[model samples]
Target: MSTSTARFTHLNPGFICENCQREVQPLKVGCRNHCPFCLHSKHVDRFPGDRDNPCQGLMEPIAYEFNGKKGLTLVFKCKECGGMGKNKAAHEDEVQADSYELILKLNKPKS
Candidate 1:
């Protein structure tokens, strides 16, 4: 099938992340499948929900931001397609572990 002439959004979430070895989440909301700490997202959707891409690869944590009492966050940019997106961290993920590590490193009585 030729691309550029086709368009899709809904995620067919059924691929396991080769990077994290975890089941991917559906395009369905509140399904942050990526490991919160790593902030890695699968190259499933091309534009948020617009799933229309040819290069299927692992999207890595490139960057992120914080606005207010929102919450922790990170960004995932596909190295293969140059697609970028931000995702909020969720519990039962690694981000929490990272947060703890960050605090620990900060509080370490300087070796």
Candidate 2:
């Protein structure tokens, strides 16, 4: 589908996470792309809100990059295709505490 059409068709639905087995709810503030519990995302969107990608891979959270303008963005690596994607962290996320802990652990400097 064209990018424009993709955006118009995009729907955020509550899903049972394939990786963590959690019943995730739709985002109250925005689109729900990732599991708020494990911070893992599916390889769905080719562009933000454009779920045109067909990889259907499990995306693992790899690292965190903080931008002054954007706050925090989580980096993800797809297990099946070895592709990477980054998504901005949400403020009203249900699993914010755990998410922050994971982000801190991943973002720590190497010794």
TM agreement with the true structure for every prediction: 0.53, 0.80
Runs in model 1 deviating more than 4 A are 1-15, 23-29, 50-52, 92-111
- Say which candidate scores most in TM-score: 2
- lDDT tens per residue, model 2, 2-108: 43554445476778889999888777656767777788989988887768899989999888787889777788899999999988877447643236666776654
Q: Report how far off residue 54 is in candidate 2 (Å).
A: 0.6
Give per-residue lDDT, candidate 1, residue 79: 80
Cα lDDT of model 2 overall? 0.76
Q: How much lDDT does candidate 1 score?
A: 0.53
TM-score of 1: 0.53
Question: Per-residue lDDT for 1-111 in model 1, tens only?
Answer: 333564542333444666767555443344453553344676765455465556666777655454467565556777877877656645334323333343222222222
Runs off by more than 4 Å, candidate 2: 1-10, 94-98, 108-111
Ten contiguous residues minimizing lDDT sum, candidate 1: 102-111
